[model samples]
Target: MRLRSLLFAPGDRPERFEKALASGADAVILDLEDSVAPLNKPKARENVHEFVLHHAGETALLIRINPLTSPEFEDDLAALSGLHPFAIVLPKAEGAASVLKLAGSLASAIPILPIATETPSAIFEIGSYRDVSTSLCGLTWGAEDLPAAMGATTARRTDGRYTPPYELARSLTLFAAHAAAVPAIDTVYPDFRDLNGLRAYVGRARRDGFSGQMAIHPSQVEVINHAFTPDASEIAWAEKVAAAFAARPDAGVIQLDGRMLDLPHLKLAIRILDVAGR
Candidate 1:
């Protein structure tokens, strides 16, 4: 799957499910955790179950279940029985242990995308994701939940940039995903109305090696997709680097455009080509 943009839709709002899929996100996350009220969770799960039954494999569909510690987690699994989403999005995931816990609970083996840094303890366990990387589709983190768990006032500064601690969380998630050889998915940009700000955010994310980003609103989907997609210049450069290495198969280092390039450059070029679907 491309996974350039994964939009979240409330599981209870089945009316908007089709709308979300039509919004051009690579995937739609049917959220049964934070978005649905406690009293509405059962109904939400039913809605998600019904939707998944009809629409499974129609698109990249991910269902964000409640945390492993929550009582609703079992019900979430129960509702998803005999159904397969593209992946299961696990919130407040601590590490490999959490991934294994969810994996063991499921009747079938399903890919997981864990929200890796929602609690203070999760930060220390970031590196542990490499152990259960095979069970994951990607790694993502949230700034909003971590601050609330820490009793903080906010995760970001007045300028809408992440504070130092939250920045650490984001960086850890990014590096951990790379360490596991999985795509690092950036968390949702909360200010859905700020298109310019979202564009800048996507630039920083792409620069920092996040292959994709989460979207809370439909308007952000096109922006994320356009920004994350490799442009003509990038594709040309990557092709040149790839062709240079291809010609000198035995050479670990080669000259490309008068600059010395190495195996890492070739690997990156291959990744670019893969992302571009070339």
Candidate 2:
């Protein structure tokens, strides 16, 4: 369940399926929307079905199906019936209602991961995800589609940082995920070749409480995994904080390293340890 990196592969490309599984990502998302052309969707669906049959239980394999509003949505669901995937990645999701709708369409109940922000209305519905969060594995956002929907030239500034509006979308998605008690996955860094830039991007995402990031390319997987994994120094600090609180079991506050350690600090320490798999 360590979703530090979810790598995407086109659904029609059965040849690359094994390669994506070998890329060291925590999960692989076989995409049926946006990546594959309309005419190729049937073949892609068959490819996904066959791939899942062969490797369903081996790793965390998810399918990014067409949006609920798309004409192809029902066919996507029909094609995936009777098969189990780690989760379904719902793109262009408006809110909890959308999650429930997809859940109802599935032959069996499976966890969902929604790209919560892709359209203008979707931004306003971010907070509604808490309603169906228990059924979600994570919540992610996208920068590309939203800008296109709004007719904006770009989502990012010349510096590669998101513009104000898109930054709002990103922040809302992060908060919504936490509010719903699910992992907040950062969107992909489209320029996959820019390792240095991707590193900096992952740092900011991790610093802001995002638990994972999407990887569009195999090379980005390593960087995402490394950035999200709790390091030795962090683990040590969490252990020390936890030990201090454990010794003062009844105390709401304790002094440690000339600082006042309180309940919130202990909570954060516990979370850090959990993330470190202690």
Q: Model 2: which residue pairs collide?
A: none
Q: Estimate candidate 1's alpha-carbon lDDT, on a 0 to 1 scale.
A: 0.94
Per-model TM-score, in order, reads 0.97, 0.98
User: Stretches of candidate 2 above 4 Å error?
Assistant: none
- The global C-alpha lDDT for each of the candidates, from Candidate 1 onward, is 0.94, 0.95
lDDT by residue (11-74, candidate 2, tens digit) is 9999999999999999999999999999999999999999998899886999999999999999
Off by over 4 Å in 1: none
- Compose the digit string of candidate 1's lDDT tens values, residues 175-238: 9999999999999999999999999999999999999999999999999999999999999999
Show pairs that collide, candidate 1.
none
Candidate 2 local Cα displacement, residue 276, angstroms: 1.3
